[model samples]
Target chain A: MGATIGRSIQCGGHRTLWASQGRSRETRQRAEAEGFEEVTALVDLCAQSDVIVSVCPPHAAAQLAEQVAGTGYGGVYVDANAIPPALAGRIGELIVGAGGGYVDGSIIGPPARASGSTRVYLSGTGAASVAELFDAGAADAVVLDGFFTSASALKMVYAAYTKGSAALLLSVLGGARSLRVDEALRLEWAMSIPELPARSDRLLEYSGRKAWRFEGEMRFISETFESAGLPGGFHSAAAEIYRRLGGQADESFPVAHEQTLTDLLAGAEPAPFDPTR
Target chain B: MGATIGRSIQCGGHRTLWASQGRSRETRQRAEAEGFEEVTALVDLCAQSDVIVSVCPPHAAAQLAEQVAGTGYGGVYVDANAIPPALAGRIGELIVGAGGGYVDGSIIGPPARASGSTRVYLSGTGAASVAELFDAGAADAVVLDGFFTSASALKMVYAAYTKGSAALLLSVLGGARSLRVDEALRLEWAMSIPELPARSDRLLEYSGRKAWRFEGEMRFISETFESAGLPGGFHSAAAEIYRRLGGQADESFPVAHEQTLTDLLAGAEPAPFDPTR
Candidate 1:
C-alpha cells in the first residue's frame, strides 16, 4: 500500500523516496538501488526530501513529529499515522512549533501505484498550500478541508461502524456455532440482512499486512467514538481481536489472523445454547 | 400485509377467509365481493376452513391454538405467529393435544400477495406431514423437515443481530455528533464510513410499523443470544428505541430519526457520546 503510494509521487516528477525506519537492509538497499537517497539521520532526510511522511505507530506519531524539524529538518512533516484527532492536532502543533508545515493526511481505501488515482484525505494548517504537491500531480488525494484533526476523526467514526459491525457479526457467529444452530443460518443471515461477512473477510485478509496500521487505527477509532459520545469499546474490542497481529516479527499480521480465526472456530467448541429458563 | 397474505392463499382454489377483528365492514364486504369468505367468528371459520392458519399477536397464537382445538376443529392448525421457539414448541404440543394436526411454522420474510414469495419454515411432530397443506401446491414456503421449533430458532437468531446492530449504530452515532473535534476531521470520518448511515436509514424507515413485532422479536432474541452465550441485552436496547418511536404517529421512523440526528449534529451542542462510556 505504501510503496504504490510512494511510487505514484516519484513517477509523477516528485522527488519522493521510499523512506522507512531503515528497519531492514532490504528496504534501505532497495531505496539506494532504486536511485533514491536513503539517509540514516532524520536531519539529512528531512533536509533532502521535500515531504517527510511518517507511517509509524500512533504513540510514535507525536515523537516522530517532534523530531522532524528538531534535527535541522526543513520540509512538510506529513503525519500519516492513525492517531486520535486530538493527537493529530497536537502533532500539527508540534510540526508548526518546529518551523515545519503540518499536513494531516488520512488515507482511505487501498493505496494505489497508478498516478492520479491514489485515494487519500488531507487536512490541517497549511493543508490548502500542499494541494499542488498531492491533489494535483500523480497522487490525487481529496482535501477533507475540515478541522485539522477531522480527517483522523472521519477515519475513526467510519471504523467504529465498519469494523464494529464486522466484529459483532463474528462474535454472534461464534455464539451461533456454540448454540449449534448450523453455520448456514449464520451465513444466510449475514448475506441476507447484515452483510458483514465480506467486510470481515476483507479485514481479516488485510489485517495481517496492515496489522501495525490497524493497531493504531483501532486505538484512534476507540477514542474517536468515545469522544463522539458513542461506544468506545467496539473499536477496542476489534483491536483485541487484531491485537495479536502485526508490529511483532513473530506475528503473521492479517494472514496469520486468518489462521487464528480458522483454528479458533475449528477446534473451539461453540458454547452450548442454554437460555436460562 | 397480513390481509394481503391471507388473500394470496385464498386465490389457490381453497376456501379461505380472513377474520381480522375491528376491520371496517367495507373491507370485509370488499373481500366478499371479490369472491372470498370474510367472517368474524374464529370457531365458524375454523369449522368451515380445512386449514386454520393463526397469524396474529404472539400472546394470541397460543390462545388461538387452544380455542380452535376446543371447537373440535380437526383441520390443520398452522401457528405462524412470531413467538419464541420454545413457546412455539409448546403451542405445537397444545394443538396436537387438542387433536389437531399442528405445524409449527415461522414466517421469516414479510407477508406477500401472489407475486413475492414468503417462506414458512416448519417444525414439530407432524411438521413434514403438513407440508402437503402449505407447501403442496401454490403456497410459497420452504418447509424444513427437521426438529420441532427449528424455524423459530433460526428466526430468533436473525432478529438478534439485525436489531441488535441497529441499536448499536444509533447509540454510537449519537456519540459521534456530540464530539468536539477539528470540524474538518469530524466530517471526514462521517463521510468516510457508510455502515452507520445506511443502517440508521433502515431503522428509521420501519420502526413504527415494526415496533410491536420488534418487541416480541427482541424478547426471543434476547433469550436466544443468551442461550448462545452472547451479550443478550442488545436486543433489549433495540426494543427501547422503537418503543420510544411508538408515541409519534407521523414519525416516518427513518425520516424522523434522520431529522433528529441532523438537529443534534447541526446544533453543535455537546451530548453524551457512548451511553455507558
Candidate 2:
C-alpha cells in the first residue's frame, strides 16, 4: 500500500487507488507493477485522495459504500462498475451519510491499449468533475445529470436492450436451424430487416459468449423492472439465454473497434447467435 | 378459378403448367392465348397432367395437402411449401387416403430470372418423378429427398432459423438504439459479429418491410411450441415485434399468389411490418 502511494507521488502516476473489492490479486499486481499505492479500505482511500473510486463487482457496490460511512470522508467515491442504479442509490446514501461525495459511475466501455466498446455514465454530486476526469486523463468517465442511481439504472436498461435482445435472437434462430429452415428464415429475416444482417453478425457473436454477464445483469433488470411495477419476464428470459451459454462469461468481451470485429465476423467461425448455420 | 386454370396452359405455351398459385393475370391471359384446355383444382390438375404438383403459400403447406385428401389422384402431388414433417404427415395421410402418390419437396436458392428463390427438398412417396418434375422446370422448382411435406417443412424450419435469429438481432439492436447506447452496444455486438452493420442495413431496407408476415407465422410457432406444452412466449414475442413494426403490410400480394396465402396469414401484404424508420 505504501509502495503504491510512493509511486503515485514519485512519478505523478495514478493520483488515487481505491480498490473496492479489497485489493484483488490482479489489482495488487498491477498496483505494484505500476508503482502505485493501494489503500485497504474506502476510509483510508477517501482520506488520502480527492477521488475514491469503486471498481468492484456489481453486487458489492453498495456494501463498499457503507464500509467507509463512519469516516468523515468528503472526497468523491465513484461507483465505477456494472451495477444498476437501485444498488447505486444505496451506495449513494451511505456516502452521503458519511459526508463523502458519491458519483454514480457506470463504465460501459473499457480502458486499455485497445479501447473497448464501452461507456461510462455517471451521476450524483461529483458528476461534473467526473466527466472532466477523463479529459485530464485521470480516468475514462462521463457524468450526466440524474440521480446517483439514474446512471446505473440507465446502464441496466441499456444492457437489457443489448444482452436481452441477443438472447432472444439466439433462441429463435437455434430453433429454426433444428428445423432445417435456416436459409428460408434467413431470407425472411433479410426480407423483413432489409439490411440487418450487416449489423447482426457482430452482435450475435458477442451475445453467444457473454451470456453469463447478461444472466447476472438480467437478474438486476428483473428486480428493477418488477419493482417499478412492470413485468420482469423480459429480463428473466434474457437470464436464461446467457446462463445457458456456459462459460462465455469467462471469455473476454467482444472487441469494440470496427476493423477487429470485421475480421472476426468475416472469418469462418461464423457469428455467435446467427442461426444461419 | 377454372378460367385461371384454363389460362395457365396458354401462358405456359406447350409446356406443362402447374398452376401452383394459380396464374398471374398475364400468365392466365397468355395461357388461354396459348390455347391449351385448362383444368380446375389439384384433383383435376393431377389426373390430366403428365405429372401433378401441389404448391401453396409457404405457411399453409400442411393445409395445402389437406386440400387433396381422398381424391385417388394417382400422379405425384409435389408438396412444395414451407412446413415441418410432423405437419407433413397430415398431408401424407391425405394423399395415401386417396391412393395418390406424395413427394416431399423443399425448394432452395433464389429463383433464377425466370424463377424465385425456390429450391426444393424431396422426401417420401414419389421422389423420382418429383425430381423429374423439377427437371421438367415447373416454375423453376428443385427437389430434395424424403416424404410428403418434408420439403416444405424444411423450408419453414429453415425460415425459422434465419429469419427468427435476424429478427431477434434487430429487436435487440433497436433496443440498443432506444437506450442511446447503440455505439457501445454495437461495439459489443461487433466483437461477436463483424458483419452486423451490413446485415442490419439489409434488414432495414428489405426485411423490415416484409416483417409483418412474421407476426402471423409467429402464431404458428407459438402454437407449435405450446403444443409441446412448453412456453410459447418466444414466438409470441416475435409476433409482437412484427406486429409492432406494423403499417408496412401492403395489400399488394401478387394476385396469383394472394389466394393461397391470404387465408393463411390473414392479410398478405407486399411488405406488412416495416421496422425501419
Query: TM-score of every model?
Result: 0.68, 0.63
Interface RMSD of each: 6.4, 13.3
Candidate topping lDDT: 1
Listed models, DockQ each = 0.21, 0.10
Lowest-scoring 10 consecutive residues by lDDT in candidate 1 chain A?
Answer: A268-277
Tell me how far candidate 2 lies from the true structure as C-alpha RMSD in angstroms.
10.1
Give the residue spans of candidate 1 off by over 4 A.
Answer: A9-36, A41-51, A56-76, A93-101, A135-137, A160-219, A231-277, B4-104, B136-139, B145-147, B156-226, B229-249, B252-277
How well is each residue in A93-195 modelled by candidate 1, as lDDT tens digits?
A: 6777777777887665555645434456667666665555664345566666446765566556555566556555654554445444545464455535555
B1-277 per-residue lDDT for model 2 (tens digits): 2223223223444345444356577655755654545565655765675545554444665655666554566656665544445555666667767877667665544432233433445666567555544443324433443234445545554454455555555554444343334465445446545677666656544453556666666666655433322235555555655665545455343322222112223322322212121
The native-contact fractions of the candidates, in order shown, are 0.25, 0.08
Can you write out model 2's per-residue Cα lDDT over A1-277, one digit (the tens) per residue?
2232223223433464644354568667766676455567655676777776666555565666776666777877777666655566666777778787777766554442222333456676668775665543323345654345556656665565556556555544444444444454555446445564655556555654545455677777656544433334556655655555545545566634332222222212321221221
Error of 1 at A134 (Å): 1.7
- After the best TM-score superposition of candidate 1, give how far the Cα of residue A109 lies from its true spot, in angstroms: 1.8
